[model samples]
Target: MFRFALSLTLALLATQATAAEAEPRWMVTTTGGAFARDNDQAHSFGSLAVTRKIGRGYVSASVTRFGSAVRQVDVTLPSTYTIGFLSAGAVHGAWFYDGYVSLGRQHYKSVVTDLGERDVAGFSHSPVYGAGGDLGAVRWIGRSWSVTPSASLQWIKSRALRGQIGPRGGSEFETRETGVTLGAGLRVDKFFGASHGDSVSLRLTRFQTTNASAALSSGMRGAFNPSAQSGRTSDAWAEVGASATWRVDHRLYLDVGAVRTLGALGGDMTTGSAGARLLF
Candidate 1:
């Protein structure tokens, strides 16, 4: 997937270079990073995006691959996701509006653990799909600052899964799980440099969960259901971050940032990332 996106982006870059004598109309960005969790567990992610000017705004597409960790009482399930997105944005004076929709595939690993006198079990491989979208707006403050507020929604569904729990080989059960997340955030930015293109920003976001449920059947009933067995159903959490951007030239820019997720399941997570963008 990364190869395909990179190839397409390169092709577009070459095709658009002819028009670079005028104001550039296309942008390409690539970012990659890792985040840390409990027990020294580290997960990695990478993404590529291409954007083109359209009328008074812009249209974009992106591909991403990332790893996420889910904690059960005694075990951690590591999952990987591959996602693609289509996005669009429009500017009206000092106000800009944007939205994006995404589709993704997810894979989870089966795990098993021993807890003193008992054992917690594992889940069978099952088909999983996730879909989501976001709506956001930015309000420019004078020539050197801006404020952005946004809302997002996501849904994840899993096919019937066979699971096991208990001692020895454990009891077997079947279940299906679905979850939803709703989030809102605000960001403030301070731009500098002669071109006002370089900037530093601070952001705060909160997420709430709903209908994160599971249907369990067969042996041991709820013993192995992912959503049903979780410690919280309607939990909420917040994240805070700061970042900086450097305008390297008329056609290139670089970024570095860090964010921390607080009150998340399992424990807090800290992420560090760096990336570059090219305009042509």
Candidate 2:
């Protein structure tokens, strides 16, 4: 019994020493991607994220931007959108969880502008915000490959301002909507190299949303009156994507991902992304 206890104590000390030597307590990543839908124009997006380890968890801040142009008959519309995010998350054993909040804006060129102003269209703007949580687990099947399944839920709200030039000179309308989205997905990862290996991943996801918009007595949405819109609507969507990460060294990796989103108002969308991560 005495010998066994001493051996156990030595083993515990060795484990502690190994963990203390692990590299990378902080990381930064940036990603860029583009999406195109059927009968609609293509849009490009990019994001930057900074993350740091804290105890058993991590905290991150991110910013994202999107740009696009759409053509309607002889009129052309161009727009820009942006999002800012902050997240706190943890990976414990085989399970991980991420909780985040995001603030964003959407700007789109108005196709409803006056006929004479078709060459220089008016613009509509929407301010959006959301809070969400993600949960997942990593399960390794062998030494070089693993799989993860995840589920996420989020609440998003958007208030849009539409402006156009009219016979009255100019007019604006305000519309507000809220959405609760739920998603579930699975990913498979394959790893190469001996230490801090390069990896590739594939994923598929399905989602559903319950949406509500405020409508007015005129049957229009987003009225200043409290009772204008008291009801809500819903929708469902799905997506599939693949990504790969190439490890440049112990503290850097390059990333790429492509995904297709389905069941949105316009149609299905295909998007591709590339990025890099640095650890220190």
Candidate 3:
């Protein structure tokens, strides 16, 4: 009887402590990470996100930047591509939901030594947009730490533009591409240290894209090969990645993640990122 009373007292104290550790009404985060592939050049990724409370839900806006290297025909340099989006979401108990639409410009940067040692060119450029939603739930089930599972889907469209650079000037050849992506993931979070709010979260995800393109739409057929046909082509690929996040303080956090893709019509690609987060 005495032990039972002690357990009840401890449970009430734990509940009161959790209630005192308030969740943020507004927050912002930024993360940046590097990417590497088995046989390809490296890429860089970064994002900035903002969130605010709204009637049991939250409104969010985010901007993302990614830089990648592509096969060079005539001195093609690498440049960062960008995306910006707005999202609406709700978090109730252990479940959360979010929907967002994003738009961005795609670009491949390159230098044209033939035109001028300092000349730069861009190819296979396009404007891209996508809409996506994510749903997830956390289940503690009487454990010290909780686990969350999430799933997401999105549709994307890109306007393809092929670029050529020479002694004369640069030109763009235009085309189009469309695809859809599906993803599922799980995350585990554990809190340590004297402050139960200090936590570490690890997530793993698998994603697949349909109607992906093997190569950028080049305006011209393979180097004087009249028999070659040039148009839109699509394929598919799958990728998996893991990420970790650490709470530095009540208002600060840090994160890192890595991903690797396979069956990418061209070659396998790997990506990585790390960033800091803030809550208010």
- lDDT tens digits, residue span 1-280, model 1: 1111222222222322334355567888888777775465677778788888765667888877776545455555555666677776665543445555656655555444454332223443445555555555556687677777767666656543233455765443435567677777887878787466577888788867653332111011011122334423555667687878787876887878777767754455667778888887
**Top-TM-score structure, candidate number:** 2
lDDT of 2 by residue, 148-250 (tens): 7888777777654434447966554455777676778887877676353566777777767676231110000011111112235555567677777677766
RMSD of model 2 against the true structure: 11.0
Segments in model 3 whose C-alpha atoms lie over 4 Å from true places = 1-17, 69-79, 111-125, 163-172, 198-202, 214-238
Which ten contiguous residues of candidate 3 have the minimum total lDDT? 218-227
What's the TM-score of every candidate structure?
0.72, 0.75, 0.71
For model 1, what is the error of residue 180's alpha carbon versus the real structure, in angstroms, after optimal superposition? 3.1
Question: What are the root-mean-square deviations of the candidates from the true structure over C-alphas?
Answer: 8.5, 11.0, 10.4
- Candidate 1: where are CA atoms >4 Å away? 1-21, 38-40, 110-128, 158-163, 166-175, 211-232
Candidate models: Cα lDDT each: 0.56, 0.57, 0.52
**What residue pairs clash in candidate 2, if any at all?**
215-228, 215-229
Angstrom error of the Cα, residue 165, model 1: value is 2.4
Alpha carbon deviation, residue 104, candidate 1 (Å): 2.7
lDDT of 1 at 102: 56
